[model samples]
Target: MHGEFWQLDNKNPDAKLYYKDHCIDYNELEAQVQQAVNSLPSERCLIALVAQSTLDFVIFYLAALRQSHVVLLIDAALAENDRNELLEHYQVNLLIEGNKIHSLSDYTHQLADELCLLLSTSGSTGSPKLVKLSKANLVANCSSINQFLPIIKDDVVMTFLPLSYSFGLSILHTHLAMGANIVLQSDSPMSADFWHNFEHYKVTSFYGVPLSYQLLNRLGLEKMPLGNVRYMAQAGGKLLARDWQLLSDYTHNNNIDFFVMYGQTEATARIAYLPAEYFSRQIGFIGKEIPGVELQLLDSEGERVEQFDSQGELCVRGSNIFGGYSETLVELSYFENIPLLHTGDIAIQSPSGLYQIVGRSKRICKIAGRRINLDELQSWLDALCQFEVVCVGSEDEIVVYSEQPIEAEVIKQLATKLKCHSRLIQTIVLEAIPRLSNSKVDYHALKQ
Candidate 1:
């Protein structure tokens, strides 16, 4: 039986999936999903599915959902210990690792009826905390995204991001919900083969994070064959203002829509988006809340912030919000309807009603009796150096990690900008900035 989340039965039979020159139409895809479903246990149980970017992964994921089994998506490349830890902690009944399905335990799980999917809060950090999502959450999010993004049955999307990541998973959920064709590939955007597939399949929509867009810009995006491209989107983290402007100009000149979005795993995928028409004018803003979602800004006392340009904590209320978080097996059986999700993101609203994230509430540190927003500081340093940099610190000192070594003179300049003693800042050079599978900076690794 098809899952209530995806309308596979209603999809056009001609809409197809292309993987390594092999194409399967929607009807055949459904048949495969049904066949995979037969491999899973008939009884509802907790499953830990390793999300690899492959056609088999897609089939198994949909199969698990089809069988009404609660699935916890784990990264395929996750460390063995971490992977085993999750299986043990969640007391998973079954584990789908690649093509092999291992029965980890025969003990039945008392998972919440509404809990359909569990995603890690951060794909990079092996945090045991998983975001609990219901079928309603996924369906609501897919509908909200489709309302803004012009995805149709004729559109073709390439899957370059890990299916374990929320941003990447949302792409799959949203496109399939619309009956849009998906092209599965594991190649990075920098690869010629990736672009070759893009051109070969006439892929229309593309999605990436800040780093992806930056790399594309360096690769001379304007020189690439983008004539068939319909739109491109960026999220996961803030794009530097300069990079945003560059992409905005490039997409506009090419008659391609460039979407700047803001979201979290808690909200399923998207919370707000800056429409392409407003891209040039609102370069740094996240635009506005998506359809059927409500965004509120609250001050430290929890009172609503009314003044424009005033910073407040962004809280979201929508059906797309996750059911709750599950840190252990016991938590899996419990479901709390969270009416409001405190994003813990500090933001300011422009006079035109656009919202821009200023910094994360927990990303603040006091150094030399001065409060510093690490995100803001990192953005400033990034714009100054024209490259990405990471900032981490305690009350005592701030450490700056960069791929390239910053000269002592530049350090002095940073100190001058911060109006603090030079001793408070230290620079570390690394061959590369550690990034998670989703292209997000690995702050946990850098901290270690």
Candidate 2:
């Protein structure tokens, strides 16, 4: 199966893409993809897949891959300015409007490795960086996932997240690689009848972020019968201990498996997935390395730390790992021959074969002449107020944002926990945290 889901069972009528009442079969999908691919100008140097949940989006994505044209997936929900800025950043050659495969005959030929995907970062620090992922990177990562999660023909996955994200791209690529069925939901999840699609479609698996977990909790998933659901994965931002514990308990109470995983845009999509079986026992850990991957912690000198509980930069080495970025190859500096993706995230390994995310070294700051991890402070603040919080740096001071009005005494207590004085603390109360389209805290916009 070198390409195009060579093993798809075309005869199955129930092989429908259950987007609400409409059922798009594998045969129809193949036809649509082929037709769309054939219709492309072929001259277009860069093709952008910019739709959300339409059949056109799915077909175009596969079509772009098959056509071997560098495809740039644009988020349909992105602000016009942001989208334009991204296109400018990547120098996109062509734009494909939603639901319409408008001919682009301006580009006469494909340039070598032009720009596959201009993936937008969370823009936590500033503007979202366009991580240019290539077709080679996509193919390698999709192949790598097959080593861990067997992409059997029987497998079915639901696209619950936005098509703009890397995880969403992975879902499309990996499932297509596995010849698995992809069930696209037409209705927005905000609608009351969203869960109906899940049930009606007989969705086998799902993936989402921390907010999705919070939403499920708020939606009251106590009695829903998800009969065909097999597994679910969560990543993106750092999942709180309380949230992770709740999910772990939920999966245990039921027989459903939950995979708490970790990765970044630099590594294609996923670098590690905590096995669902280990969910109950590990609880808060991000799990061992994924298949064909080596997860190691390197000291300041880039030497592997042997002792348990030793904190170091979480480095990843594997075939799924990308070579470099699109515009420039920022060769990851290392002290040894080991070429590891030096994830700025700091972690401490337990003897039990579990890795606990401590905090990012970049986020650590000096407050009141003492080093403090903002993540640590945020966790402590959340514990005190029993609500979500994020800590960011402003000059020499630390600013805290919370969902509800937090008492100054509580912040003083956090100072005590950090062994610091209260005068160095500043707290901001918000009714709710503002999130990016991808559900991450919009730090850049928040700074305004």
All candidates' TM-scores? 0.97, 0.88
- Per-residue error for 65 in candidate 2, Å, reads 1.3
TM value for model 1: 0.97
Residue-by-residue lDDT tens digits, candidate 2, 207-275: 778888777665655755467777777888767767777777777776778887788877778888777
Q: lDDT of each model, Cα atoms only?
A: 0.88, 0.69
Cand. 2 TM to true fold: 0.88
Candidate 2 at residue 197, lDDT?
A: 65
Which stretches in model 1 have alpha-carbon errors above 4 Å? 1-5
In candidate 1 the C-alpha lDDT for residue 396 amounts to: 89
Over 4 Å off in model 2, which ranges? 1-14, 102-115, 123-128, 150-152, 186-190, 327-338
